[model samples]
Target: MPKANSALSRRAFLTSSAAGLAAFSSIIAFRANAQAAAGELLMVPAAPNPHGAIERLFLLHGDPLAGPIRKIVTESGNPVPAPTMESGARRVLRLMHFNDMHNHITDMHDKRGDTHRMSQIVRRMQETRAAAAENEVVLLLGGGDDHTGSVFDELLGWEPEEFVADAGYRVNSAAGVDVAVLGNHEFDRGAEMLRLGIEKDARFPLLSANVHSSAHIARDRDYTSAAVAEVKGMRIGFIGLTTQVDTRIGQPDDPDMGVASPVEAVRNVLPALSQVCDVVVILSHCGYGTGQSRSGKAGADRMIGEGDFDIAAAAGPLTDKPVVLIGGHSHTRLNAEGLNPDNVIDGVLMTQAEANGKYLGEITMSLAADQGRTGWFTHVGLHPIKSRDDRVAADDPKFDTFEKEDDYDAAFEEAHVAPLRLALQSKLAEAIGTVTAGDAVSTATVEAERYVGENALLNFMNDALVKRSAGFANGTVDLALFNATAILSGVAQGPLSFGDWYDVMPYADQVHIATMTGAQIHDMLQSNAKRIVRPEEADALDFSGFISRGFLHFSDGLRYRLVLGDAVADARAEDITLHGQPLDSMSERQFRVAFNSYVRLGGFSEAWNGKAIGAGVPGQIQGMDLRGLEYEESGLVYRNEIIAQIRQDGGISADAATLDGRLTVA
Candidate 1:
C-alpha cells in the first residue's frame, strides 16, 4: 500500500514462493495475493507432522504466539487441506490481553471513601483466567506501561538496567504475562532497568523483534527482543513496537530506543517463525491505522482485513489488524470499531479497558490447524472484579476486603532488594499541602476535577489561577478549564494532601500561558462543551475531547451562552458574559490562560486550536511535578464544577463514560 515493497514483486504475487530452506522442515511459503491490491503475506507449514517439522515461519516482534486461536483442527494427517481451513470446524479462541497496569496494586481512597480500581482489575484478570485457564491455551500479555516504583520491581534509586522479574505480582497470577513489549512510560525508568526486569523478574518471554539493540541482529544479543512459544503445540510468534513520540517529549537520558517499520517487522519475522509455528500473530505496540492509518487494509476485516501482516493494535491505533490485536496507550476503552460487536466494527472485536486497571479485555480467537493459517479474533471487555458500592455488595473475598488496613503498602513495606521508596517518600512522594472548599477535607486524597456532584476541586483550580494572577497585567482568565478525562476520582470537599494531588493529576505537566484571541477562545469553549455535554454511548469513559481540558473538565466560565439541542451542524451560542457581566460580540481581546503542558499541544485524540501566549510560574509545590497536576487553579481546591452545577440544574448532563454524540442542550 505504501508503494508495494520491492520484495513483493508481481512475480512474487502470482506464483508460489519457493519453500526455500523450509520445505524439508515441512513448511511451505504460500505467496498468496490478498484480495486487496496489496497482499496478505501468510506463511504456514506445507504439511502437519506428528513431530511438527515445518520451515518458513513468520514471527512478529512483541507477541508470543500472536494468538489465543481455537484449534481449527488438531494436528491431523499429512495433507494440510489447501492452505485454508473449513469454517464448520472453527471454535472461539478466548484470550485476555491488557497493558499499562504500571504495577499498580492496591486501593486508592477518594470521595467514594475507597476506590479499589487496581484490585478490581486483578480480580477480573484472575476470574477470566479461572474461567478459561484450562482452555487449549490462554495468553496474558502486556503492552508495557510498567511505571517505576510500582507493585513489582520497585525502582527507587538504583537504575532499572539492574533488575528483572516482578516478584510480588507473580504469586497472584495462576500464570503471569506470557509476553510484553515497550511503552513510552517504560522509558521513564530507562531501558537498562526494563532489560533487567525482563531478564530476571519475568516468568514468561518478552518479545520485541522490530526493535534491535544495534544494526542488524547478530547471534548472542543480550536484549530479550522477541519470542515464539507453543500453544498446545501451535507455534505462535510475537513482536513488539513502541511510540516514537518519545523522542520529542523526553530528556536524552531516557531509554534510547528505536523501532523498525512495524509493517516491515512483520514481513521480516513472520516468514521465519511461520516455518515452525502453525499461526503467526503480531502483538503490535504500534499505533493502529492498520494500513488504514495509511489508508489501506491488509489484515482480515475492513479495519484489519488481509494484509502483508496479520497484526493486532497493541496500543490504541486508528487502524486494526486482521489477526489478534490488543490495544493499549491513550487508555481509552475498546469501543472504537473492531472490538465490541454490540456497536460493531464488522463485529471485528477488540477492547480498551479504562486506565488505572478499571477493566480487562478478554478475547476469543478461532483458528483451524487443518485450515493451515486462517483465523479470526474477537474482543470482549470482561466485567471488572469490583467492590460493593452503596448499592451493591462485593461478591468475592478479593473485592469484599481491601488489604489497605495497614498504614503502608505491603508491596513496598517488605521489599528486600532496596528501600528506595520510603527513602524518597518525603522528597519525591511527600505531602506538603492541602486542598478544600471551606474546611479541611482529605489530607491524603486531593480532588482534581470534581466530576462528582459538588466540585471543590474544579472550583479550587480555576479560582486558584485567577487568584494567582490577580494583579497581573493580562489579569486572570475567565476560567481554568480542565478535561474531565484526567480526573481519577473525587476527594470529599476538604483538605488535600500531597498524595491526594498525585493520585488526581499524576503527570509532570506544568502550567502554561496562552494568548488566544476572543474568537479562538470562544471556538475552544464551544468545542469544549461539545466534548463534555455532548450525547455519548452508555457506560463508557468520556473522550479526552481528542484534546485536553482548557477550562477545567466541562467547567468553562461562560464568556457567551452556548445553545445546542440538535445535530453537529445545528449548534450555536449567544448571550455572552464574562465575570457575570454582559459582553459584546465584536470585542477582540487576548486572554491569559492557565493550561497543562501536555494539553498545550494536541493530546491523544484531543486537539484544541488555541494559540499559546507565554510561560507562567513553574512549580510543583510540595514535590509535585508541574505536569502531574491537571486543571490546577492557584487557589485551594480544584475540580470540573460546571458538570456538577449543570447536572443539578437538570440539563447538560452526560455520563463521564465514553464520549460520543449523545448530549443535548437544555
Candidate 2:
C-alpha cells in the first residue's frame, strides 16, 4: 500500500492494457457524419424506467465484449456523438471519482469488496488512455461521507483522534485520491476531533470553502477552504462545501464551526481560484436536487426552498470557468440523464457515484477554446464497479439471506485492510443468542411484507424499541416507530452474531421519547401512507418502497387496520389502539411516544404540517418537553440496544404460526 501523501504519479498507478482498450472500442462503433455536430451515444439495457438505464461504459476481464451492447434502441437507447474535440485534440484530464462511501471498508451485499476494485477500474481507464497515446491527466476524487456506516466505522468511535486516519483516509490514500471534500459525516464525532484527526492527516487536500470555525478550532488546525492542483500542465482549482443539514441531523451542536451557503461560498472563492487555475471544480457534499421541495425545477431558484444547497443550480451561475461539480450527501445515482437541462445549468456537468462504493463517476475533459474559455467536458460516465457478469441472481439462496459470505477481494483484504476486518469480525461475531427453528426471518421477507403491511423482522424490531423505551421511561412510553429503510438487511436462522445485528441495524441514531397528540400520530400515519407504493403500482420483485416510504412500523402493542385506496391520505386507519385501549384524538389528549431521533426531529414530515419538526421549525419537540413532561436521553445507541434486547429475550425467531397483525392493509 502507498504511504499517505506519497507523490505517486498517475502513470505508476495506471498501466496500459490492450484488452481494456479493445473493450472500449467494441462498445462504440461510430458511423461517418458529414455534419460536424457533436454526437452522443447512450447504450443501456432495456429497462422499464429511465433511471434504471446503464449510463456508464464498463470494461470486464475474460469477456471483453460482455454486457448489454446493442444498436441504438429508440425507446431504451440513444447514440449521439460525444462533444467533438478537433481531430487532433488531446485528452487533458480523466477524473475517476466516487462519493458517500460511508465507511464500507469491506464489501458486503451489493458493494464490490474493497477500494481495490475501484482502483482496478481506474487502472483500466488509464490503460485505455495510454493505448490511445493521449496526454491524459488522471486524477481520483471523493465527494465525502467517507466515514460512518458499517461495523468498522462504529468500532472506530472508540478511537476519536485516529478515526479518519485509521479508516477512510487510509483507504482513500491507498486508492490515490488526488482531492476530496469534507462531508457532513466528517463532523459526526465533532469539529474538534475532525480537525485533529482527518483534516490533519489527509494526504491530499481536503477542501471545504464554506466551512469555518467561529472559535478558530478548525481555522487554526489549517483546514483550507480551497486548494489548487496542477495535473499535466492544466491548473485545476478545487473548492469544497459540506451540506448545512449537518446542523440539524447528526452529532451534537458545535458552537464553533459554521457552514455557509454553498452558492455564496463558491462565489466567494471563484475569483481567487480563477486568477490562478485554468479549470475550477467544486467538491460538494450539498447533493444534486431541486431543493427540499419535491417540485422539479431548473436553475439556482430551485435551491431556495430546499434546506441543503443544490450544487448545479447554485454553482452554475457563479462562474463560467469550465467548472464541474462532484457531489454527494443524497446518495443519488447520476449519469448522462443527470446532465440534462432540467438538472444542471449549461456548461456545468455534475456527477455522483451512488453510495457504498457500488459505482464510479468518470469524466473526461479537454482544453478547448469555448467562447474564450479554456476548459469543457468531453465525456462523462457513471460506471458500476461490478461487472455485468458479477450479478447475483434473484433466486440465489443467498440473495436476501444474511449469512457469512466470501470476502469480495480476498487478496486486497489480506494485504491492506485485513487486521481491521479481523478485529470487527471477532468482536461482532459474538453469539448474542440463538433463534429457534422456523422463527428466523430474512431481510427479503421483511421488506416484501413491510410495504403492504406488517413483517416479522420489523415487528420484532419495533417491539424491541417499545420494550427498551418503556424501561427507560419507567413504563410511560406508549408506542415506538421506525422507518423501514432503517432496517438495512435481515438475519438468517440459527445462532445470531452481533455482526448479523450490525447488518440489520447499522446506523447510529439515538433514541428519543416525545409526546404527540393521538390526532398528530394519526396525521403522521396519514402522511406516511401517502408515500407508500401499492403492490399493483410497483414491480412484483421491486424493493424501492421499503426505502422510499412504507408506513412507519409501530410496537406490537399498537395495532391498526389500514384500508388501502386510490387516495392514500384518505385511507382509513381504523380501530387504532394502544395496549388494547382505544386511543384519543389530538384534540382530546396527548400520548407519550418513543422513536429514533430522526422522527423526533421531523425527518419525513412536510413543512406545512403542524406535526413537522426540524432545526428551524417552531413547536419542535425539545428534550421531550410536552405538557410539562420532562425529556430524557436514553444514552443508549439504537443498534446496541437492539442487540442487548435480543440477548435479554434469549433469542428472536419469526413466528411461523402467527402474524402480529399490527398493521392490516386491504
Candidate 3:
C-alpha cells in the first residue's frame, strides 16, 4: 500500500508544449502545472472477469496539451458526433470527480468521523485506479468549492492556516484531482490570494473557461485559456464554469471585480474550443436545482437551456458525458438525465450531490471511434467524505501510517483550529437541554438541525438573539423571524461551552431586525410551517425539521397560529394573530427580527425588507460593560416560557415522530 503525501509541492511545472500555439491561433496556456506525488499508483477499476486483459490505470497526462489529441473535434460545442455503440478499442474514461470540499483538511475535528470514511473512499479510488491501470486510464477531476477561506475568514476575522495549501493536501491526499474547475467559494480568497495560493502548491491545471484571471498572461490578453485535456488518444476539451454569482457570496479573497456570465463565456469560447477538443466536459460549480438548494443552477441551467455550450452541458453531473453534468452547490441527491433537452436546441445532462462531502460522482464513459458515446449514472455506492469527528475515533489506524499524513496536517494550523474552535467542541459534544424525557432523536446525528427533539444549542442561540434584540428586550418591534439557516449540526448535551456554539452556528451572519407587514409576516410563518412535510412546497420556507418534535422554538412573546392543509395555494387568511390578538394593522408595530447577517443581507432566506430598524448581532469584541450586554452567550438564553409555547403548538401528531412518523409526533 503506497502512503499518500500530506502536502503538495507548491512550485508549478507546466508540462504543455508551446510548439503549436501560433498555428492554433486561439489555444493558450501560460503555465500548465500537474506535478507527481511519491510514486502513488493511478489505477483503473478491474474488469470483473478472469479471461480478458482489462486494463486499469489512472493517467497522469501533463497539463492541457498544445493541441487536440483526438481527430474530429468541435470548438462550437455543436456538431456533436453521432453515437457510436461499437465499443471498439475498448476505451473506458473514468473521471474521479470531487467537489464542494470546504477545506476539511487536518482531521483536527475529525468532522463526523469522516476520516475513516474518507480513507475508505480514497482506498477504493486507489484500488479502482490500480485495476484500471492494466487497461483503461482514469481522469481525476476537481469539481470545485476547494478553498473555504470565507468560512475561516469570518470565523477568525482573518486567514487561518494556508487554506489553499490545506485544500491541495485534501485533493492530493485523496488521490489528487487531475483537472479541476473552480467553485464559487474558491473566489473567497480573491485574486492575489488565489494567485498566491495557486502559485505555490497547486500541481494541477485549474481550468475555468468562464472565469478569466485578472493578471495578464505575459501577453496583452488573458493568462490561461480554458484547457482541453487529452486522455488516451481522446481530445477531451475541458472548460470550467463557476457560478457567476460570486460577487453576491461575499468570499472576497480575490480582487477580481466581476464574473463574466458563464453562458456568455462558454458561447464566446465554444467555436474555437470545439475545434480544439473532440468532447467538451464542463466542470461546473453551478448547483443542482432548488430541492438541493445550497446553490442552484437556476442560472447555469438556464444558460445551458439556451443551448450555448457542449453538445450538452451537465451543470453538476455524475456520469461521463456522451455529455453530462455533475453539480455541487445546492447539493441534491440526483442520478438521472444529466440533460435538459430542447427540440430546437441541443440537450444537457445534470446531477448534484447532497452537500457536505457524502457522495462521489462516478461516470463510466466509453467513447467509440465512430465519434459518438452512450452513458448513464447512479447516486448509489456514494459514501460520506473524510470524517471530522475526533472524540471517539481520533486516529483511524489506516491513515496513521499513510505517507501523506505529514502533508495533510501541515497546511493548516492544527493548534489554532482547536484553540480557535475550543469553545464550540465541548458544547457540541454534549446533549443540550433534553427533550421531555422521551423526546425522540434520530440515530447517528451530528448536525444541529438533524435531531427531532428540543435542542439546547438551537433554542439557546435563538433565545440569546431574542434577549439581545433591541426590539425584543425593549418593546419597539412586533414579532421577529430568525430562520434556521443560521444553525446546522447540533451539539450533544453537556456542560455548555463556546465550542458547541461555534460548531452549531458555524457561519458568520449578524443578528438582523426588520419590521414586516402583516402580509410578509403571514407569508414568513406559513413558509416556516410548511416544512412539516412537503419540502418542495416550502420553497421559500426557512424552517423544515419535524415541527412537533421541536423543529424550532420561536422566542417567547412571539407566536402565530395557522390552519394548514394541502396545496400552498389553499393557504388563506387562517389568521396572523400576534400575542393573543389580531395583528393591529392600524397600529405601526415594528418587529425586531433577530437573525444572522446573511439573512438580513438576503441569503437563502427572504430578503430583509427594512420596514423596521436594524441592529447588528452581538459578538465577542463589543467592549467591557457594553461587552457583557452585547456579548453573545451561546445557546438560547432559555426562557421556559418560549419552550412552553413551542410545545403548545401541537407539533407532534404521533405519526410524525419516527422516520416512519407521518407527522412530527408530539
Candidate 4:
C-alpha cells in the first residue's frame, strides 16, 4: 500500500519494527498503532448501521421514507442536505464518473455514444467544482475502457499527420480526469502499446489492484493498486480493480502479468486503506454481476467471480469505513434516473453511467465526524449528454428546466475536441462503396433475433470471410463462423462511408483458418443451440436483456435445425448439413473453418447454467485443442477483409445479405 496522508503509515511502521520484533509480532504492533492513529482521523459510528440502513434504503429507494435521492439542476437547484442525522457541521463531496468511453471522440449526430458533446460534460464538471461550497469537495473519476472502438482508436494504424494516436488518453487528460481504473480494452493492443499510450498521454494515474504486470504495466510507475487523495482535510482512499477476463485478450510478451480475483485483491487492500482514509471508494472495471443478475438472467454484463457485488461482499467484513464502488466494464447504467435499490449490495453504494459518454453520473455524499462515523449518499443524478436531436424531454417537472440544457463551452470544444474531429473527417467520410437499396441488414433486428436463428448480417460477414480466407488458407475454406455480437452495427441501403463500416465492425480482430472434425463442429453447433432463447419461452426483452455471448452465426454452407425445448440444456441442434451433404458427427471428415482471432483465442464464453466462466478457457469451442490445433492465422483483420470484398464487388445488396433456410429454430 502507498503511504497515505496519515500520522502512522502501515508500510513504514511495519518495516521499521520488522528488525526489532518477530514478523507476526511486528504486524500486530503495526495494526495496533495504525488503529490508534486512524481513530483521530476517522470515527467509527457509535452504532454502525451499514447493513440495516443500506438494506432499508435500497429496498425503499426513491420512496419518501428512504430519503429519495434528488437530481440537481445546474441552473437553479439548491444544495441537498445530508440524509443522515448530523450532530455537527456536515461536509459535502460531489463525485462525477463515466466509463467505457471506447474512443468515441467523433460527433455521431444520430448516435448515442458520441463524445462530441464531451465539452458540455467537462463544463458541467468544472462548474460543479467551482460552485462547490467551502465545506464541499468535488472530484472527477473515470471508470475505465477509455479507449478502443471508433476510428479514433485506429489513429495509429491510420498514421495521420496530426499524430492523434491515443485520442482517449489525450481527451481524458484535457478533461482534467483526477483518477481512473484500468479497463480490459486498455490491453486490447497488448501491454506495450497500453504502456506507451499511458506514458505519453495520461496525466492521471491508471490503477488496478488485481492486475500484476512485469513488463508493460509496473507498480507505482505505471499504476498502483490503491491511491489516496486529501481534500479539505478529508482523506479519501481508492482501490482499483480490473476484470480478470482481460487475460483472454493476452499480453503474451508480458508473461509474468496476470489478473487475479478482484474480491481477494480488494480484501488485501482494504486493511491498509481502511485505517488511513475517512472514506474509501472502489474504482472497479470488473463489471456488476456474476454471469447473471439477481433475477437469474445471463448476459455480457457478468464478470463471473470478479464483479463489484463479489468484491463488496468480501470487503464488508474487513472494513468498517464508508465504502462506495464506482463500477464499469458491464457498461450498465445503474441508478440511471435516481438511486436504485438494486445497486446497493453488501452495504456498498454502487454507481455506474452508461457506456460511451451517453450519461454523466453525479453523486453527492455527506460526511460528518461529530455523529460518530456518518457518511451517506444525499443525491444521485445521471445527466444525459446527447445532442439536441437525441435529447428526450423529461416528463418530471423537477428536471424539465434542465432537460434541454446544452452546457457546451465554445472554447472547450474548439480547443480540445474540434482538432481531432477535423483530422478524421475526410478519411471517415471517404466513400468505399454503396449498399444497394432495399431491406438493409438491420443490426438491431439481427441482435434481437440472434439467439432464435441465423442472422443476415452475420451470414454476410462470414461469407465474406470465407471468400477472403481461401486465398490465405492454401485450400478451400469450407465455411466461416463467428459470434453475432462481433458485428457492432449494421449497414444501411445507401452510399457506405469508411466511418459506416468502422461503426459496423470496429474491433481489429484478424481471421484465422482452422481444421475442425465433423464431431467437433457438431458439438460447437449444439452448444450454440443451448443459448437460444425462443420468443415463446422468453420475451424479446429477456432475449435481448443483456449482451449476447457465444451465439454462433455461420456461413451459407452450414445448415442446422434447432429443436426448441422447455429448458436451455434440453434444446438441440440436429440435421446438420455441410454443402448440400449430411455431416456425420462421428466421421473423420475435416472442414477448414475461418473464424476471427477472438474466437480462436477464447474470447467467447458459452452461456451455461449461469455458472461463473473463467477467461482463457479454450474448451468453449468444444473439442478444438488449443495445444495442437491445425490452424494458421491469416494476418488479415476480419473487418478489413469484408471491406476489401465490398470494394471488389462495388457494394452489397439486400439479396446478398438475406437469410436463407440455413438455420431454423423449430
For residues 1-666, write the lDDT of model 1, one tens digit per residue: 012224434453223223312232353223433111111222222211111112222222122223321122112212222232122333234556666565554333333344443444444444554554221345666665655323233332234443434432332231345566665555443355445544444444444554544232211132333454443333455555554432113222332335445545544444434444444444545443332122111111111112222233221132122344455544545553334443233222334443445555666565544554334434455545343233234675454443232322233234431243343245333333332233212322223112211244443444445554554444555545554445444444434344544455544334445555556555554554443223332123222222222223422344444464464333444565555554345258655566654454333223332222101101211111123222323321122222223223332112222122112234
| Superposed Cα deviation of residue 642, candidate 3 (Å) | 17
RMSD of 2: 15.0
Q: What's the lDDT of the predicted structure labeled candidate 3?
A: 0.39
lDDT of 4 by residue, 1-666 (tens): 111224434464334323322321222211111221211111111111221111110000011111212321111122211122223434566788888888865455444334355677777877876676655667778899887788887654422242455778777777867778998878765677777777777767677877774576675557766665545445566778888753444423565777877877776567555655557789998877764432222333333445777887887777667788898887777887788877777667888887878788988877654332344545777888755433444664444333233556667778877777778878788788888734547656655666567777777788887777656636668989886556666777788988889988877676777788888788677766765555564442444444445567899999989987765546788899998888884458988888676666664343322332322222232322232357775656677889888887787776667788799988
Total clashes for model 2: 12
Off by over 4 Å in 1: 1-97, 108-140, 147-178, 183-234, 241-276, 284-323, 329-355, 358-413, 416-456, 466-481, 529-560, 565-592, 609-666
TM-score of each: 0.49, 0.69, 0.53, 0.77
Which ten residues in a row are the worst by lDDT in model 1?
A: 613-622
Q: Is candidate 1 or candidate 4 better by TM-score?
A: 4
Query: In model 3, what lDDT does residue 299 have?
Result: 10
Better of 2 and 4 by lDDT: 4
lDDT values, one for every candidate: 0.38, 0.55, 0.39, 0.63
The candidate that wins on TM-score is: 4
lDDT of 2 by residue, 121-182 (tens): 44444554455323456677888988767766654563354443446766666556777788
* Ranking of all candidate structures by their TM-score, best first: 4, 2, 3, 1
Decoy 4 TM-score against native: 0.77
Question: Could you give candidate 3's per-residue lDDT for residues 339-364 as a string of tens digits?
Answer: 22321123354555444445566665
